[model samples]
Target: MTESVQAWFFLLLAFVGGVSAAAFSFRLLGYLAVSLRRPRDLRRRYGAWAVVTGPTSGIGRSVALKLARKGLNLVLLDLSAANLQETSDMIRSRHGVKTRTVVFDLSLVGTPQGDDSMRRLRAAIDGLDVGVLVNNAGVARPSVAYLHEADVELWVRMLKVNLWALTEVTAAVLPGMVERGRGAVLNMGSASSEAIPSFPLNTIYASTKRYVAKFSRSLYVEYRNKGIDVQCQVTHNQPISRPAFKFHQQE
Candidate 1:
């Protein structure tokens, strides 16, 4: 009986080790494949124009600049007109590519005015050969607080901006991608989506981010064969409090 128990333990240990090694190897290969892709590959696989929501600041701005550098023309969307214009100008100057800006608040997604804004957004991209859509606009409460302590208004705003806006924008853009038979949609997610460590004091924010991951994964599976690549980029780091370059001139 003792010998049999020892054999079973060793077998279990070996199986776990093998699984871990295989997971690591697969991840390494995936990273290597992504690293090997060039800017031209993006243009060829996706298209020429890339749309970035929340392009005025933070990670959205960074993504917009990188895509511009890769020879993609830009359609920038944000709430601040001045900031959107500044981002558009910078992309044109640095990358020598064309850029168009659309300024609209995402927090009012279900309102009549929001519908008009969506119509405008669709109109703006109508004739363009858009290749990539980055649904990066989102909001969080100003500070962390327990569920009952959190501001009710902020919670509603977070849901609109983080969840509703993402779905609306993707719906508007995805049909075009499907018709064209080639495009990419990148949804920004948070590390909290994994929920392994259990985030505290920010329940609403974490839940919304978790929704983004599940939504993106579902879309990816649905459209993988239709030449649409959907990805949820899970970020672990917090946004920079101060950006190095001010993309917009202060009003």
Candidate 2:
């Protein structure tokens, strides 16, 4: 009996090790493939125009600029008209790519105004050879708070902007890509989606990010063979600006 138990333990260990090794190898290969891909390859596979949400500041702005540099015409969407115009001008000056700006608040989704906003967004992209969609518009509470302590309006807005807006925008754009047989969708996710390092205070934010991750995974599976690549980029927190020296100095 002792010998049989020892054999089963060793077999189980070997099986686990083999599975781990295979998973690691597959990930390594995928990374290598992405690194080797060229800008022209993306243009050929996807198309000429790329749509980016939240293109006013920080990471979203960075992504929009990079796509412009890759020779893709841009459709910039943001809540602030001034910031949208600024980003559009900068991209046009630097990359000389065509740019269109759509300014509307995503947090108002599911309302009559939101429906009108969606109609305007559709009009902005109409007749353009759009190929890439970046669902990057998101929001979080100003400070950490427990579930009961959180503001009800802020929580509702968070859901509206982060999940509902993403769904609606993707739905609006995906059918065109499907008909054309090529496109890519990039969704931004947070590291909080992982099981480790539980977020005690930012519970709602973490849950929303996890939803983005799962939504991207399922979409990828459903559209992989249809020439649409869906990816959820999981990111860790990074300082966007200098830390405030005093509590009153915080922006």
Candidate 3:
């Protein structure tokens, strides 16, 4: 433990931590700027309609509102029919934009009910020009636990929503976007998914989001020539953390 060696070690650690902090800060500031400036003009660039899943609350609600403000008609989906109608009506009243609501639970995406919901979802978006798809529906564990101690069924439901539902929605939306020859898909990811060193307490959840990131990147490359822009946004509850390693995942 010589003084010079210790000095170099501390410097190296600081460099790594600073880089992570810088990335977090950059993403936070960029998001705020985009939200405030509303400079993208998504409707003009994409098409007349956008479909946003889980639109009843949280990030989904915010995204739906912003898209409406940008002058894009909306197709809002959520598990609760009541919530769906509430959000839809609010958006329509506030923005004076057309809104359609569909109640579909992403966690039950493999059952008969889910199949029916899928068909209904397809019918809902059939003829319109869906220029943007926001895969914002998601779920997470109610309580933190190690993998071995986790409840199996709960984890399975999370997977169905996070992976299966998002994938199916993307698949359904892509054909129309391809035919129109222009669109964008935004898949939501979490900070737990390799956005940090690791998410040890939330192992399975992190892995699913990592899959989202990988799936999005591959799709971006696959469809870029086809006029499709697919992007995965990794988010943290706090845009900035005090200690630089407290980035927590959002549901």
Highest-TM-score candidate: 1
Which has the higher TM-score value, candidate number 2 or candidate number 3?
Answer: 2
Off by over 4 Å in 1: 1-26, 37-40, 195-197, 236-251
Error of 1 at 154 (Å): 0.8
Candidate 2 TM-score over all chains jointly: 0.81
Which model, 1 or 3, shows the larger TM-score? 1
Rank candidates, TM-score, best first.
1, 2, 3
Q: Tens digits of per-residue lDDT for model 2 on 165-215?
A: 999999989988998998988887787766456787888888887788788
Give the alpha-carbon lDDT of every model: 0.81, 0.80, 0.82
How displaced is residue 87 in candidate 2, in Å?
Answer: 0.6
Q: lDDT score, residue 39, model 3?
A: 63
| Model 3 poorest 10 in a row by lDDT | 239-248
Per-residue lDDT value at 46 in model 3: 79
Model 3 clash pairs?
none
